[model samples]
Target: MDGPPATPPAPKAPTLGNALHRFANPGRFMRLSGALLPWLAAAGLALSVTGLAWGLVFAPRDWQQGDTVRIMFIHVPAAWMAMGGYVGLAVASFIGLVWRHPLADIAAREIAPVGAVFTAICLITGSLWGKPMWGTWWVWDARLTSVLVLFFLYVGHIALSNAFDDPERAARPAAILALIGAVNLPIIKFSVDWWNTLHQPASVTRLGAPGIHVDILQPLLVTGLGFLFVFAALALLRTRTGILERRARALMAARAAEPAATPSAVAV
Candidate 1:
């Protein structure tokens, strides 16, 4: 009698948790990031320069806003990165809290200051654009207010993360704050629709069609992508630095703990 064919081994399911776990090793992250860093940095710089030149010099002026509209090249991208950075921060924090990923805490810590700078750029540029268009340097508009709050949240996270005497103890509370602060992201996105404000409603991101003309929209998209690459490069660099710093600190602690050698033993 022919025996029944043996069953094949079941394939494992791929999930977010599993993927995160696979990349949790700090050494693996360092090697991968190191290999990719130069390429990412070069791409980022090239794109940024190309996009800025195209937008500032070549793109047609807006019918209504004129050259001041050119500010969007930097302002829009900074705003996008500011929000995107926080999302990354929150995700890193979540991974750190749940899986105890070795690099997650380092990622969260490094992302905060960079995100804060982007947020500040967004606000400053928004104000610069506003003064001419809105006839005011500032307003308590919903979108503006929420973005300001987001900036403060970034600042708070940075301060809190560095406040503790022990690096190991610093991450948890900041992570919790990050998770809680995520509520504001959606608010910032929807504020124009949710409330009447001085800020314009979505032109590029709306459903049906992007209200922006292709001439302007193309450059905007390019610049925005460049900013994204810049963010990635910066984050990877900072995370690598953080990893090296931790290793150095561990080495110092190990050396400090060793017993002092006797003078007689040294002479012998």
Candidate 2:
């Protein structure tokens, strides 16, 4: 019987709130992810399958692009997510720095590689598409240049974040870097107008409406949603893995610190 009676065990740790505050308990994080992963996995599979079916089989070939139009479903979404992921990283990094949310840092760290992959895919595929359409493998246009900057930014974040010995110290500078790079995204979006570039003007977003027709648009939209879900699922899985790895390292360090106990029970 202590003086304060142990402070009521901290009110049972509030699962619903803990769900929102995921980094509060590693066990809760594991449980929530375990429950959610299956659904995300299922939905991702279903969407990709359905979207591929529509895009490849049912959707009409573009009169101009022909079979190459199929590539747009993948290319456009990869480009969108590449930019989207970087913005997410910057936001998460900012939250981690300002609020000191551990989960936010993990999210930022885990997402960068995925974003980099998407950015590379977007660039390569765009180049491939451009070769046939524009008669060149690469161009010095504004859109392409901005995307190249994005790629280098991702590389810089990855390299700089790991350069420091202390994780916290590394995280802060990396966060700042992410914020600085985020400004390039808007430049990437508006580059066609601000500067004369070989890259085409906005086709997807226009004052009147989308330039593309419904038949192609439906597949494009479907694939985009599929890609979005896939990104979410992958991000969650990677973040969870990072959390577990950190916990394991902590436990190992704790074990190393404590003295080894002698075996007392009889054994065969």
How high is each candidate's TM-score? 0.93, 0.85
Per-model CA lDDT versus the true structure: 0.93, 0.83
**RMSD of each candidate relative to the true structure:** 3.9, 5.1
Off by over 4 Å in 2: 1-26, 260-268
Whole-structure CA lDDT of model 1: 0.93
Which regions of candidate 1 deviate over 4 angstroms?
Answer: 1-19
Candidate 2: tens digits of C-alpha lDDT, residues 1-268: 4575555555675654455465545577678877888788778778877887888888888898888787787788889899999989998888877767677777788888889998998999899889888899999899999998999999899898788865556788888899989999999999999999988888887779899999888888887787777887888898898787677778988999998665753332
Clashing pairs in 2: none
Candidate 1 residue pairs in backbone clash: none
